[model samples]
Structure formats: structure tokens, C-alpha cells
Target: MELIARATAVVGGTIAFLRRMGSPAHQAFGATPDIPAARKQGIMTLKMPAAEGWKDGRLPVCAPGLKVNAFASGLDHPRWIEVLPNGDVLVAESKEQAGPPKTLMDHAAQATMRRVKAIGTSANRVTLWRDADGDGTAEIREVFVENQNQPFGMALVGNRFYLGNTDGIRVFDYVPGATALAGSGEPLVAFKPHGHWTRSLIVSPDGSKIYAGVGSLSNIGDQGMEAEEGRAAIWELDVATHEARIFASGLRNAVGMAWEPVTQKLWTVVNERDGLGDETPPDYLTSVVDGGFYGWPYCYWGKTVDDRVPQDAAMVAKAITPDFALGGHTASLGLCWMPDGTLPGFGAGMVIGQHGSWNRSKLSGYKLIFVPFENGMPRGPARDILSGFLSEDEKLAYGRPVGVTLGPDRKSLLMADDVGDIIWRVTGAS
Candidate 1:
């Protein structure tokens, strides 16, 4: 049995080595990347970091002049966060439900994820934490909301709270200073569940509208485009009337959305298609325009057509390019605006939580990264805000960060590390 397994691994490695022809990973950065020809999708190139918990009072290494501490721990896969005006922090705890594998590929993918402790039983609830004494620790913990459907994104608008579940958005009438949700939630909008199941929600700056991000149901429409209706786009719904419109389309997996403080333009981080090579079509951060069409099934990075999918030349022509490339298969998920002086040694920018890669040959993006913005546009390559999530050999992950948001105090940073089951708080190192 051991010999057979060894032979299988060797065969897989040889296949990957022979099929490797993508552009350099670094070449995939910046506004204009050198996208090379798409490589053949081999048996799947995977390098997953073992999800290990931090031991012996250890913590993630932050950039200079910043410090991090576990604001709350022992969570059941805390993947998203929202801080209330009263300084209460809400952590959404959930995990993917892959279900029984259907084929050899499915079984292998499931096994890889399971070995890394990625897939597990979903907690299906949101936990709230309160730091009453401003001591950088949460002395209070409670289940703020319960009976959610694989919740991910969270937002509290005025007296109402919104939760992004796998199938739709739920809104509840919230009471001030309340640690737990007092009322039952009602459906705000419905979505086709499965595939990329996590939906992210964010309120408009004026609080007049709510935007929900729905990702693709398949890697690149392998499940037929009709099955992808109402997915892979950001939907804007009126806060009062509940009227919704497809604000932007063709986003493969738009996860995180933010308003560029300087420009006030909508921005998002999208997970691009896989099997196209390590860096041929990189995931991106871009300003989403009203009715904007970003290439998903047809093209990427400014209409560079992906030849794999059945082409529609007209649809491909309408594809608008993304603003910046954020490394291929990085799975950049968490995004939040950080103003000038918000964090030490960092200017105004967007802070992203890269959930790390599962399909790339070499590991990428297992850290909290910051992309500096000058006048609301990405200025340069991303800088590490908090790193060392991976072990020295890069085969183990102490944590995988997801949602990022401003702390309840409005002066600190809060990040969720799902694998480590911890909600980390970041503040200046005074």
C-alpha cells in the first residue's frame, strides 16, 4: 500500500512538472501582468499548509510598530466579523460543507482539504465578544445570532442587522447595546446556493443600500452558465424597498467589497478561475462600476480571453479589466479600508486577508496584506501587515485569515483566523 501511494505521488509530481508553463508568479502582479498561454489542467496541482494551532503563547508576527493578540479564541471556525457601534464584536463562525465526494477527483480534493483541517462541520452561528476594559481581550463571549445557513458576511445598519447566508441575506431588527439578536430574521433576498457558498454583505456609505457578493457556482461555468444565474456578481438592493439590481457582472468569485475612501468608488477582491496555470489569470482587486462586466468565463485582466470555455466574442469584448492583480489562486477574501495613521508605518490603503491557496504548486497568500492606495487607487505591490501564518517549512499554517473589519473601538483592527479558531485584534505597538 505504501509503495502504491508513493508511486501515485511520483506520477502526480511528474505530470505537474511536465505541464508547468505559466508566467512567473511575480509577473502576475501590478495593473498590467504578463499573462502567458493557459496550461493544460493536469490531475490538479495542490500544496496545502497543515492547519496547526499556535502553541505555547505564540502569535502571528506583525509588521513593524504593530502588535497582535487573541481578542477571542476557541471559536468554531470564525470566518467573518462585524463590530457594533457599542464596541461589541460579532464573529461569524462557519465552514464549507463539501458533502460526500462523487468521483476520484472529488475524493482526492476532499482528502487534501481534510488533511489540512480545512473542511469540517459547520458551526452555523455567530459569536459576539466584548472588551469592556479596553484591555485588548474579550472578557465577554456570547452567541449573538443562531440558526444561520452557513453565514459569512455581517453588517449592522442603524437598528437592523444583516447576515449573509449561503442562500440569501437575512435582516433582523436589532436593539442597541444588545449582545444577542432579539428578533427573528426575515429573508431580504434569495440566492441559488452551493458551489461558492459564502455570500458577503456590506452597506453603502450612506446606509441607503446593501450590496451582496455572490460567487460563481463552478470554477468556470463547468456546471453550465444557466446554473450560475444570480451568481458571480455584486447585487445592490435598496435598504427600504428591497429592490435589487445586478450592480456588476462576470466576477468569478467576488468575496470582499469596500468603498475606496478617497474616490468613493466600489472596490472588490475576486477569486479568478483555476487550472489555467499558477499565474496566467490572477485574482484581482478592482473598482466595480455600475453594470460593469469583468471577464469570468471568457477572459480576464483586460479582455485577455480564456480559450478554454466556449467563447462568446461579444461577451468577451464587453469585459472590463480589473484594476490590480492579486496573485493567482491566493483566495484573497477579507478587504477593509484603512485610513492614514490607522496603523503604524502604513498610509491609507486596503487591508486584505488572503485565505491562502489550495491549488497552487507553491504556497501563496497566508497572511494579512495591505495594498497602499494613493487617492483611492492601488499604488504599488502589497505589503505584509501580519505574516508568519505559515510555518518555517511553509507546510503548516498556524491560521488562515478571512474577514477583516475595523474594531468596535473604531481605532483598532480585527481579523478572523478560521483554522486557528481565533479572532485576532491588531493595534499600534505603543
Candidate 2:
């Protein structure tokens, strides 16, 4: 037993030493940020912080003029949230059910997940929180929908409520004041199984179409491009005909998507590839063009080719450079636009929920950031809105922010903290 303990300690010390030495030099943030040359490796770096639950009387720190409070607590793995028009908040309690490990990489990933308490039986349900008395806290909590298959994105158009499950999009008839819903919904579109599972949905400005962001299966088409069909792109689904087509392509993992209020253009926060050192191939926020390709396996950040994949000259020529960079491997997700005139000092901007990094030598994200917009483009660097999710030493995490949305009142921001199982409310301080 003593020998085993010593061996484990040695291994842990070696890993820590490598991580400190391998930390990237450049900081990955801001619009038009620098992309340092990649330090490529055959086998990727494995660095993940240990997950630690928050202690009693502990809470995150908000920005100077903002205050933070828990709006709801004790949720079962809340991953995404949507505020209904009638002032009710719907939260998806979806967790990943990672089965037995198949390959060596799968074993390593699963081990990391187990250490972080990430693998578990999924709740597979959506809960509704209603604050009928305007108390800023939910007085009524009920199961809005149940028995879902890893549901993530949600949208409501007219009287139809759309739920994007891992395999398909389900549509249901929504009544304004109902507390709960049951019965099997009709499947609108089917998706083949893939690696990047989260499906973010949004209704177009005219409400005539729905856009769904489907992520790629492998890190860089490692399993071959044949397995990545209908993946790694945004799909435009016609509302009336239920017809769907690829709207954009080659986005490694476009998770969080929203419609810019000014330009009426679709913007997305993408998660770039891993294995390269921390600074190359920064994840981006860009205005997605219809039928456009952003270069996944063949290239990155427009024209820089990833030599790992076979060169495709034709596709490389057509790759479009993204509008903004949100840092490399930061896993930036969860996009929500600040409603016009909601807050006085804060101008037209968008809040991004960066879920933090697992592969970097040092952690990058784990907070909510605001990117100011001017004429439909990111104007400056991202400002941290709510932070302090990681320990002071950056070795432990209390929570990871996943989804951000405007509250029912439209005056504050609501963020879903999956690790803490709490809905953090942030608003301007009095």
C-alpha cells in the first residue's frame, strides 16, 4: 500500500510540473486577438482541475456595480435556461451518461469525468421556476417537462415549444399558463449521434425560420469525414415546411448562438480544437454567413492549415475568417443579448458564459463576460461580469457557468451554474 501511494504521489507531481512548464505564453481573449503558433503533440495534454463543491455561505463575486444572488438552488444538473414570455423560467436538468470506456482515450476522458463528478445518471427533465409575487425568488417550482433524452436548447414560437434533444428536435403545443406538460412530442428533425452533443436553437428575427447549431463528432474529423455528415454546422429549418439544410459549415463546435439585435445577423461562440498548445486556434465569435465554411479539419481561423488533416485546397480557399476571437480552448458558450435600455450604464452588448477549460495547462474561463457591440460588431475586449468560480490557486472549481439568459423581468441576467446547481442572478447594485 505504501509503495502504491508513493507511486501515485510521484505521478501527480510529474503531471503538475509538466502543466506549469507547458502553460501557453499568450493570453487568449478579445476581438481580433493574436493566434500564437501551435505547439502540436501526437497525444493531447490532459489537464483538468479537481471539482470541489461550494462551502456554506459561499457565493461568487460580481462586478463592481453589480450584485450577485442565488435565484434558485439544488437543481439537478441545470445546463440550459430559457425565459418564457409569461415570466416563467425553464431550466433543463440534463447530464451526460458516459457508459463504459471503449478505447484508451475514452478511458482517460472517463477518468477525468469521474474525478470531476461529471458522469452520472441524467435527470432528463426541464423544471419551471415561477416568481408570481415579484419577489425576485421563485415561489413555485414544478416539472415543466420530463423524460427527455439529454435535452439542451429550447425555443418557443407562437404556441409551439421546441426542445432540442440529442437525437432530434421535439415540438409541443404550449399553453400560456400551464404548470406542467406531458405526452410524447412530435419529432421535427432527426440528428445522427455525434461527439459534440449540445444543440442550441434560436428563432429568426422574422420568426419564419429556426436555426440549430449542431457540433462535430470528432476533434478534427479523426474518425473520418464520413462520420461528420450533418455535423459541425448550423442548420436552417423552415418553420412551415419542416425542411432543413446546412446554413454554415466547418465550425468545430458552435455551441451558443444568438441573433444580433442591430444587424439582425446570427452570431455564434465556437469551441476550437484541442491537442495544439493553448494559444493556437482560438475559439471565436463570428457573424455566420449562409452556406459559409469556417474551416474545421482542413484549416483554422480562416486560412491557417492544420497539417494533421489532409490538405484540401478547394475548401481552404473558401474558408471565411471569423469576426472575433474569444481565446483558445476557453470553451466559450451560452450567449444572451442585453435587452435595449434594460440597464442604464451597460450599452448594447452580449453576455457569454465561458464554461472554463479542461485541456489547458492553466485555466482560462469560468465566468460570465460581456462584449460590447457597435454596429453589429464586437467593439473591444471582453469585460468580466461575474467571476471567482475557481479557487485562488486555480486548482479547484466550485461551479462552471453553462447557460446565460435574461431573467423573466428582463432587468437582470440569469446564469445556470451546473456544478453548483444554482441559478445565479446578477443585476446592477442599488
User: Evaluated with lDDT, which candidate comes out highest?
Assistant: 1
Please list the residue runs of candidate 1 whose C-alpha ends up more than 4 Å from where it truly belongs after superposition.
1-27
- For model 2, residues 89-111, the per-residue Cα lDDT tens digits are 99999876776666766666666
Each prediction's TM-score versus the true structure: 0.95, 0.95
lDDT of each: 0.84, 0.83
Go through the candidates in order and give the C-alpha RMSD of each one to the true structure: 2.3, 2.5
How does candidate 1 fare on TM-score? 0.95
Task: Enumerate residue pairs that collide in model 1.
Answer: none
Clashing pairs in 2: none
Q: Global lDDT for candidate 1?
A: 0.84
User: How big is the positional error of residue 399 in model 1, measured in Å on the Cα after superposition?
Assistant: 0.8
